[model samples]
Target: MLNTYAIMMVLTLIVITIVISLVTRKFNSSTANFYLAGRKVGMLTNSTAICGDYFSAASFLGVAAAVYASGVDGMWYAIGFGAAFVPVVLFLASPLRKFGEYTIPDFLFARFGRSHVARIIGVVMVQLICIFYLAPQMVGAGNTWNVLVGVGFLGMSPYQTGVVAVVIIMMFYVAVGGMKGTTLNQMIQFWVLFTAMFIVFALILINGIGSYASERVPLVNPATMTVEKLMAGEEGSRPYDQAQAVMSPEAFAEVEAAVQQGDPAASVNVVLPQTNKLHPERTMTFQEPGHRYDWLNQFSMVLALVLGTMGLPHIMNRYYTNPSGKSARLTTLWVLGFIGFFYIMSSVAGMGGRKYVSELSGSDPAIADLTVDGLLLKSDQIMPVLGKLLFGEFGLGYVAAGAFAAMFSTVGGLLIASAASWGHDIYENYVNPKAPEWKKVLVGKIAVVVMGLFSLLVGIGIPAIGLDKAYPSLIAMMVTWAFAISGGAFVPMLLCSIWWKRTTRNGAIAGMLVGGGGSILFIGLNILKETGVFPAGSFGAALGSLAFPSIFIIPLSFAVIVLVSLFGRQGQPPYVNSIWARIHGTDALSERVRLAMQEAESRGRA
Candidate 1:
């Protein structure tokens, strides 16, 4: 039941988006244009679009939900996401663009002896990572739709409607306009999401979310029921924690007085130090970190995000859109700025939602079922619920549109990535090498539809399979798993392929098998453990600690690739010298490398 005003806004956005895609349709005459925008994209535009593609539902909704639910522990996602680009800038961006292929598989095949074996392995890995990444965006879209529209469409639930709606809409644009259209849409979507977030952030600050005091700020324990006082020397030290201690008027008064007086020995029972408008006895602070992660999990999660950037298929594909290696390098600088600002705003929105919901629960205990610890029942609902509570229906509409924009922009990029891998890499290279440009484009469009449908089906099954309930924040958890797999499987091999000439096709294949397969197995086992299929014993606990497996899986992958390469005794490709010059040398050198690659392809080596 969307109101008239909200429906109009959403429909208006859809119409405008379709128009933009149609206008960009002429740019898809060849595989190069359809796949990489003819490598002519400028710096700022590509940078913004890359941000759009990189900031999926995980960044839009999951990050805020995480902060709302877990406090400072949540901001680690923002930090790691932004920090990921550092490695990209230093090692991958320029080399990837200079190598200049439609997809990662294309680059791998050309770099590793022009073997279809390497390309096939890359295609499989890309599909796995993209689909895993895509499902969360779909889930986030569904959650936003449930809040904004909350109506069934054509016998579909709100979540189902969202999944189908986004897939179809995004597929239309991607299949019709290809890389150029998707890039334009991503750029526009990023601006829309950023502006809407800024408005919400400003409104929350203006409305005084940080100005009130709370006497009972809720808290949760991640492991066992272990509670400790926030202050160093409280009266009752055993279990008189902040949340429980605030219930005692005599104890609370003494603590509150000492805090108010700013005594040197007085300790504050707060995590973030923000005013809790809902209750007078409790306050929020930003200093807490162990709410959701232990030391090992924290380090592993950061490792996954930091290294995963080099391996994300949709993200890496954007570098190919830049005109040159240098342009790609420059684009990353702008991306860093854009992503940093977005994450900062994400923290604001999360805390604002926490404050708002706490205020609501303070006024009425009946709303407690709708929330947990002053956050939504489903953590992903934080931003959407805040939209209506903070600014009414119009604000809800605006943020909901932004949510969909985040989904559409990322899904469009993913669809294009799948298309490039399937159409250019598999179809043209294997199934139909003599296919015409039009045929190849047609195949790509078909791939988009197929992949979109497949992703939609997977998204629809998330709630039924209990993934939404098993994970704290569905989008973040799923996205992190995708990152773990990417970091484990692709990063090591990619780095070796570019920086080390001894990398062989067999070694790359072995790494993917051992590292990627092991990560998937561990993730599956963790999910089973989380879903109660296995008892939580000491061994189970240790397995749970391996939730973020990239810390171990990555090193294993690097070891396998290196060990196999050293022993395989396969000589480097004939074009390795030119490839090296292209990756590390000038655009002139890149041109010569491209000519050499073409000569290889003409000789059937590619």
Candidate 2:
């Protein structure tokens, strides 16, 4: 049955979107107004909007799921996500806004003496990053819908229902409201999500009514009819003791069915319920690191997330919506504060989930009913599962609303970013340079529809290919791939162009080709190996780490760019002094505007 409260929250979201659309409708007539909201977004609103766009399902659900499943190592994602802003504030935020471009391609082309090569490269990279990122958002939306509604519409599967519904709704808002409506919606959604998350954390962690990772869980030996403490998995090995702890007979049969169908991860490790390795007398705590990530994995994951934030097109484009460079800097500072608090809540949610599933489920008959044959079959479903267990349908409704917020806000920003890349950067520049403003806006709307449909298709198909098993884990992995690609392909070149005077167009192109191409290739190989296209062995294990390629690909990109620039005879980009002065100077808004205009006019002459 559909939850009435969930339906009401979703309807409320629709109504708010409609009101914002009506209010912002007048601002959509011009390409400039449509894309950047007339560059009038304030610091607090912009920061909240950015958080709405940045958090996504990955941060909201995936981080919590990671912590629930893996314990202390899961906190690494929260740490990396929060720390990502440090570089954004110190290096990119103000300079990027001062540079003043509609898109990443726009900035790169203007910075590199209006090189068409740079613009085309930027469009390609932006499309790659946005498209890859878009798929996971769609998948997460579908996952949320399954939990919220628990039923399909018009014979469509639950996953398909989610993908179609969210895509169509977001496409309408993005197309009609453009950036103005999307920005306002994002700001509103951020608060809704933040409030929902805080409530869950307060109830679960502060109340101490829920189980924590550090607490000992009770497990029953089906054969012996005896109860014992359940131990946590330690570093360097899987806990066979847990596998040996059998579920109900129905669950045991299901495990056997899964193993028979080629799912080794689900296969049981013992013939009977066992507890020797579990140390039934002791309790396990999640106070240490290295539960899932080794030192190398930790370094690579952190590097990708940090460097990747700089290159993400959807995020970089937000700076352009700021009225001035100073506004952009302030926005970044606020974003840092918001993101830190949000991640703390995410950690709490994860711990709460761990506590709920492990320690609390067996104590209460009502809570026990929420489990699948006495165990959490899929860890990714931890949040929704907990919602129903702890607070019934009302809690599920609130969580569903928050999940929708996470999905819709990020998807809205991404579609706009994709539309701008295709319509303004590619079509306006290459296909119809003389197109009028109205025609350009029309093209942007069309691009939004096209991109939304494409992502929706990918989201629906992901489950058929067996990639949707662990709800948030698969989503997180795909998102990390997008991050890795962005970090390798764009971060090195972008940072060099802004900070180093020696960066040449040729060098940037070389770096993008090597870094971007290599990252994609590595991801493809990793996918192939994962899907059993490559036999299991050393080669497959090596390909495993390649899935997170920033550690290696980023360094390689830096080297390629530096080496190519050193050998190239290209002169310094025109008006380098003025560009640097504008980037680093602390001038009044009007003075900054004058300098920006002068720089643009110089680029026009060149």
Candidate 3:
């Protein structure tokens, strides 16, 4: 049966989101209002909105899931995510806001001497990053729906239904309300999801079910498990010994049946020993470093996330909405605090899920079927499943709503960013330079619809391509791919163009192609290797094992920019000094506006 309370909560959130969009439609008369919320949002409001944009399914569900599945390694996702903003605050925030552009492409084009090539390249990077980031959120939506609603509609599977429903909802709100509507909705959505996380954490403490210290306790004793090994003559093998040790007899029977039938594709829940990837001689445990990454990848993953935040188009786009450069910096400071607390709570909740879900699975056959030796089959389902186990239907409802809110707020920002790139960056600049304000806004809405449909297709394709089965935590893994691409492509270019006076147009262009293109090439190979397209022990597999490419690609990109600028005939623009002054100078316009507003208020009082 559908949890009526949970469904009601989800529907209420959806209703409110759409209503806010409809009400804000009136404010979107110009391109500025439609894309940047008229560039007048206050510091606190924009800070919360930025948090909403930043915390996608990866932050909400995937971080906790990663912890539940990978232990010590999983905590890295939370740390990387929270630490990403440090670079943003120190380097990018104030300068980007002061320079004052509507989109990343706009910044690149102007900073690189109005080069059309730079603008086009930036647009491509923006769309690629947004779509990559958006797909995982869709996956989270589908998985959450499958667990919460447990049924299909309109001949679609529950996962498909969930993806379709969210896409349709996002398309409507983003098209109708524009940035103003998205901003208001995001601010509210941030608090809702944050509160839900806090409540779950509080409940775990109050009930005395688990504590932060409980993470040291393994859900299944590693000693009771056997290491997986290939049989001498068998074509395919099963961990029958491991399954028998941990699973109930009834569950073991199904494994036996699959093995007897020679089903090579069949799998059952089994506890197998973890290998120490970082240190080959060491024994692996829940508190160790080698559950997922080797030593090389541990550093790679952290670099990707830290540098990636500075490159994210959607997140960077929000800086333009700030009224002043100083306000933008303050906004980032608040964002660090909000997301820091949220990530800590999410980590605690992951530890709690490890204890409670394993204990409850034994008595509940339904829960047992979703687990393998007490560990969930899909880690992304941990939050909703744990909620239900702890507080019945009400907990399920609240968590399900929070999951949707996470997707909604992030996806809303993405759609707006995509629209701005196409509408303002491309259409207004090249396609129809003289187009009226109404026509420009219309094209932006059209772009939103197009991007929404594209995201839906990517969501459905993830499972079709076998990606869902390739990673232990699919949402988090896919998001890291997006981050790698962003960091490699944009961060190098942004740092050079903003801070380096010798950065020529050709240099920026070459760096972007190298950084962005190389990242995509490596990520594509990683996917092929994971999906069994490249067989084990092959050179292809070895090359594809570097999952996070940021560490390598980022430095190469910087080198390309510097070498090209120093040698190339296309030197820095003649107006480079003026551009530099604009970027580093104080915000005189903001000060004048503040004074004007105060004077108007004083006159009215007299």
Return the top candidate by lDDT. 3
What TM-score, over all chains together, does every model reach? 0.87, 0.87, 0.93
Candidate 2 error regions (>4 Å):
209-242, 246-288, 358-375, 470-472, 538-541, 587-606
> Which candidate number maximizes TM-score?
3
CA lDDT of each prediction against the hidden true structure = 0.79, 0.77, 0.86
lDDT of 2 by residue, 478-592 (tens): 8878888899889998899889888888999888888888889888877776655677686765676455777889999999999999999473576677667655666464347
In the range 1-606, model 3's lDDT, one tens digit per residue, is 278888999999999999999999999999999999999999999999999999999999999998888877888899999999999999999999988879999988878766889999999999999999999999999999998887899999999999999999999999999999999999988888898788778877776645435444433322112122311234433345544555667656755665576645544345545567887776666666677898878999989988998999999999999988999999999999998999898888887787788788677665676776677888898888877888778888888889999999999999999999999999998999889999999999999999999999999889999888778888998899899999999999999988898999989999999999999999999999988899998999999999898889999999999999999949477767767777787798534443454466469668
Q: Candidate 1 — number of clashing residue pairs? A: 16
With a 3 Å backbone cut-off (N, CA, C), the pairs that clash in candidate 3 are 6-397
Off by over 4 Å in 1: 208-218, 221-286, 361-369, 372-374, 538-544, 604-606
**Which portions of model 3 show Cα errors greater than 4 Å?**
208-238, 242-250, 261-267, 363-366, 569-571, 589-606
Q: Cα deviation of 199 in candidate 1 (Å)? A: 1.3
Worst lDDT run of 10 residues, candidate 1, spans: 221-230
CA RMSD per model (angstroms):
8.2, 5.7, 5.5
